[model samples]
Target chain A: MSQELKQTPLHALHAELGAKFVPFAGYDMPVQYPAGILKEHIQTRAGAGLFDVSHMGQVRLTAPGADAALERLVPGDIAALSPGEMRYTMFTNDRGGVLDDLMVTRRAGDIFMVVNAGCKTEDLVLLRAALGDAHVEYDEDRALLALQGPGAAAALARHAPGIAGLGFMKAATVAIGGTEAWVSRSGYTGEDGFEISLPGDAAEAVARLLLGEPEVAAVGLGARDSLRLEAGLCLYGNDLTPDITPIEAGLTWTISKRRREAGGFRGDAIIKAQIADGPSRRRVGIKPAGRAPARAHTAVVGPDGAVVGEITSGGFGPSVDGPVAMGYVTRGCAKAGTEIELDIRGKRHAAAVVKLPFTPHRYAK
Target chain B: MSDVRFTKDHEWVRLEGDTATIGISEYAQEQLGDVVFIELPTVGADVEAGGDAAVVESVKAASEVYSPVSGRIIEVNDDLEATPGLVNESAEDEGWFWRMELSDPDELEELMTAKDYKAFLEGLD
Candidate 1:
């Protein structure tokens, strides 16, 4: 039986725009508007796209040593995070597998964290159990919106001035339509953008304000997925699972040098070990030689026709105008330009291991 | 006018003597959204009634298009390989997927007629 689906604050607004609804992460989220995914994907690349990310888990951690407390969970250097700075990291299990990847920001007098929607419940439970002394509060009454693209800053600056001045990975409390909103110069699309966290009641008004801009079009989960895939960003459940480690996922950059040596986070021992001697199987980009897209779970075959890996995330990248995929392959076959085959429905199609970000990242540095 | 038949899987068949032209219905294309790629069976292949005949990939997901009747594939739509969006633009007419020589004419009776298919679609909502 299907469970009851939750709706975000912008659900009605999305409906008004004729969005196609699909069940995602327990929420009845808009997968695409009437413009369709292909056009929406292109629009985002050329201009700005507004996304409703309110279903994601937003929480605030308040305590004197909150930064240090968070360091015990993830491998990122949270202690060195200056105020109004954000870092992308993940919570790992003791077995060196990633529990959930999240974005942590050092806010004024507290630390703000946004986790994946599906893992939010367990993540909150885990955080509460581990950090008993710190006051962990889930921000259920807030809505998060991401405006991403090359033109994102220009469109956002119309309503929230000085947002253009905020450097990448920086966050600040700014005024949007006279309401206080926490704006961050960060996004998952590999585009220069801002994620706005504001009161739920003000969500529709803010969304309309952004959409009213000429450059900003309302984007849904479909275009968002393609854009991120083209940018080589990982989706939580698809790419980063509890069975996958940060090192294997090519997320070694998230583990700072100091964190690598003075390891204190969960799964640090195994992570450090993998860092020393490279991981057996590494995540790499796969570019199918044809138009046929090799979707997730498609077997990656070696030259000898033996199954070497499986596609974690694969789809047609509108920007790249071809089929692009990412999957785990044996280290020997993980090198760029290595030839492989994708077993798509019993038929093997020639594929090559290419560098990630099929479309080069256009983030504002 | 050609006698058109429909299957529960959303595939449509237009019968002309012993030959039949097949394609997904307009409703199917609408539900599938923007079709980016289509993989149809090669010509001269044998297909069974209710068997998987082709694969239609939209930006969101991939769906299997089932053969409505048992037949020998005579010709497959090569145009879909170059411009799959045609399936979205003219799913029933210009975007037909394949042509087959009927091996079992009796199987056509088991499918829904155009009128019956219209009612079936209404009941789906």
Candidate 2:
């Protein structure tokens, strides 16, 4: 029954704005608005676009030595993160497979995390088991919203003063609409943006305050998927499944040099070995010839017609005015300009490996 | 006015003389959101009722448009290759998928008229 689907705090607001709802991650989330995915994606690239990401889980850890404890679960140098700094890392299994990808921010004595919605249940369980129930406090009463694009910083600064001072990957608490929110200068769209974590009751008001800006528009999940795909960012479940490791996903750079030698996190042995010897398969950017987009699970083939990998995320990129995709390819065929083919409905279409960020990233450094 | 009919699959056909103009209904376009690319069926090819006649790709996923009646494709819309959003903006008129020579006008009896289609959509919800 549709009643079983959970609604976010901004659900009524989305419906009022003519959003079409779809079942996603146990939530009745907006897939697109009357402006459509293409327009929303373009609006985000040019101006600012608001996205309600409240379905994602926000977890806080501050009992004691939480950052060090989190290092036991991920390979990133968590201990090195200074206050207000953020890092993108993944939870790995003993087999070196990525459990989930998350953003870790060092707050005043606590560690804040944002994880994928679908993995929240398991991620919370894992965190509590490792960090203890007293330390892992799930902020279930909060909402997460992302404001992205070239004009995002200026538009957001209107409500939250001093937001423009925040650099990329920086985090700080700011007040908006008489409510405090954890604002982070980071987003998955490769645009300068902020991910705001605020109380649920104040979500609609804060969202309205931002939307009042002429340059801001309400974007839905459909544009979010296309924007991230064009930005060459990985999506969990589609791109970073439990069977795929960080190394195979070509996220080795996320594992800093200091963390490699310390090596106390889960799958440290396997991940470090891949860093030194290189993984047999590597995630690479794919540009299919023509306009036909290759979706997830599309078989990737080498010039010899041998199956090399499968596309994990793909769709029409409104910014590039074409299709873009990401998938794991054999190390031999992972180089840029390597000829490849995509098997769609028993027919093969021409494609090639290309450098990532199909559209240039507009993040403010 | 030409006789117009709609299929349960959300496609519409209009008969003017021996030629039948085909396109998806507005209801179908709304479900599809923004169409990024459309593969029009080959001109001069024979198609049967309910057969997959064309491909419509939106930003997130793809859907198939079926031929509502048996016919021979006479002309495919070339404009869609450049601007597929016409389907979303005007799926009934300017966004017509193709024109075909009707092979069986009797097949129209199996479809729903404008009044019947409106009631059909109402019953769906």
Candidate 3:
């Protein structure tokens, strides 16, 4: 914690925007701007919200069989990915718990991956040791930006013409103002959006260009967390960790049929076993019947007053206009509509198990 | 007929005779951002100075609204149960958290006046 914090390419812009900074994952990042988290969350759903994702690690795997090597580390069917196709997958430990969840895109001969800011260092170490240091490279010069919302494509289309034609989970290399970027028609906000990885130096200009667009606004980590929470997306350290397996965390869909059947990846046996026989605990969406939000670490009890689990993440869903959360509960209580109680401030409150996401996804598939 | 004072924790107390109305300061509400819910202390509850008397849940975090001085709760703000954003809209007046009878009026002397509170906020940044 004593070490100096890092800054992104858009740090000065965030300061100019009147952002309140906070230290996140070893970086001095903006938590929220003057408009605040609520407005930003709503804006991301209604219009395009730009996020500086440069803190996330942009890694490259340059090898003939990079997909195959990546497949060994993740349970996803990486080798089956067609060129320019992206898949959401997780790096699992030998015990089957997630090391880090990442996005893997199959490039021409090599592969590209984006990892969480906090987990990147360890993820790099793991990848280098497995895929050889010569093949694994994390480019510090690269900066990433996420333009997310229903109007994201419209805003970006003005800058990059072909972006409108991009389908969900598809990737394209497009030029914006002479800067080449690896653009993907995917985002974690459960909305139709794009994740653009471009040169760090050009990042500010591109961000400025997008922000100049009528629909785009600069968002921060605070709204990003709330938006993803309402979207039912998992945050790395909170909802996912080394102690939680892909199956337990409700990410079994990430494991391809081939990998599930062949069982060759790290912790394949355990993961596959859990796949066949359901995990003891399963992550589920929570809806509080009242206004009070049950924040993270609050204990969840079942109908009979038995402790079922604990809330991984919880907060006021600005769009939903109430409290929504996600957590791992006993398999018996994971079903939708199951009654539960959350111990908030020493009092139990009635809540219900609901299907994620709290809102419907509007992907441009 | 009322004296206004501010606490270091950012709560505000408006003392009129023996009864005082309490709420967070504008500076505090802006910091918390978009109040979604608030848990008010019950009427007739006796609370000590600096003790937690209300819970304010913002979109980003949950913070305790402490009593600026020792008092016995006489009334609670029920409006916050439905319109918590009032804290953000009118933090000092309409968004007042509760009303209580001061058990020890001398404690108000330890709080900051309007000028002092403004200076405190200045020193913060």
Per-candidate TM-score, chain A: 0.99, 0.98, 0.99
Please tell me which model should have the higher TM-score, number 1 or number 2.
Answer: 1
lDDT of the candidates, in the order given? 0.93, 0.93, 0.92
> What's the lDDT for residue A75 in model 2?
90
Q: For candidate 3, lDDT tens digit of each residue in A1-365?
A: 89999999889999999999989999999999999899999999999899988999999999778887788899988988899999999999899988899999998877999999999999999999989999999988899999999999999988898675789999999987677899999998889999999999999999999999999999999999889999999999999998899999999998878889997788999998899999999999999998899999999999989999999999988889899999999999999999999999998899999999998999997
* Worst window of 10 by summed lDDT in candidate 3 chain A: A157-166
What docking grade does candidate 1 earn?
A: high
True contacts kept of each: 0.77, 0.82, 0.77
10 residues in a row with least lDDT, candidate 1 chain A: A126-135
lDDT of 2 by residue, A11-52 (tens): 999999999999999999999999999999999999999999
TM-score, one value per model:
0.99, 0.97, 0.98
Please write out the lDDT profile of model 1 over residues A1-365, one tens digit for every residue. Answer: 17999999999999999999989889999999999999999999899999999999999998778788788899999998999999999999997898999999998788999999999999999888877735889998899999999899999898989686899999999998788999999998989999999999999999999999999999999999999999899999989998999999999999888999999988889999999999999999999999999999999998877889999999899988888899999988999999999999989899999999799988878
Task: Tell me the spans in candidate 2 whose CA falls farther than 4 Å from its real position.
Answer: A1-3
- Return whichever of 2 and 3 wins on TM-score: 3
